[model samples]
Target: DAGITQSPRHKVTETGTPVTLRCHQTENHRYMYWYRQDPGHGLRLIHYSYGVKDTDKGEVSDGYSVSRSKTEDFLLTLESATSSQTSVYFCAISRDEAYEQYFGPGTRLTVT
Candidate 1:
């Protein structure tokens, strides 16, 4: 209802598996971001895109990748996920920096 949704709200897998998380949005804002919130590290940026075909890596982009071919969709892929990657992932969008960000319900990933 907040203009966005995340798929596979909960996932559990082995230490070596590929995972892909999907973020779907109704508001065609110019900015979208993926962040992981761990126990104490707080929200760490993973990747973000300013517009279609325009993207950049964030602080925690290791083993992760993202794509935004359209304004309404963004995807985050973990190439060979590992146990250390276990965290709650969140997708957020902003039309302007001054306004509040709308966040999608998180995806919890657990690797054993």
Candidate 2:
């Protein structure tokens, strides 16, 4: 797990509702990322934080937001969940600008 943990490993929600997923790491890594996995889309980056309160949007950031206030915690929020947004979300951490990233067990989200 590389000291990374995602909360609410399983979630069931209705369409148009809001959902939030959390990712915590004990490694105190400077870089944290959020990604979603779907059958055909592979993995798409949602958002990332480089340092405390320093966050940026990723390729697929629409409808999602992220925040990081501490070195060990990163939070991802879906303003309004949709069935199209149903996917397994992952959290990853890196110590530096390296290609290697350690991922947390995914959060499985379902929208009906």
Question: TM-scores, in order shown?
Answer: 0.94, 0.96
Cand. 1 Cα-lDDT: 0.91
lDDT per prediction? 0.91, 0.94
Clashing pairs in 2: none
Q: Which ten residues in a row have the lowest lDDT in candidate 2?
A: 92-101
lDDT of 1 by residue, 13-71 (tens): 88878899999899988889999999889899999988988889999999999999899
Clashing pairs in 1: none
RMSD of each: 1.2, 0.9
Q: How close is candidate 1 to the true structure, as a TM-score?
A: 0.94
How far in Å is the alpha carbon of 27 misplaced in model 1?
A: 1.0
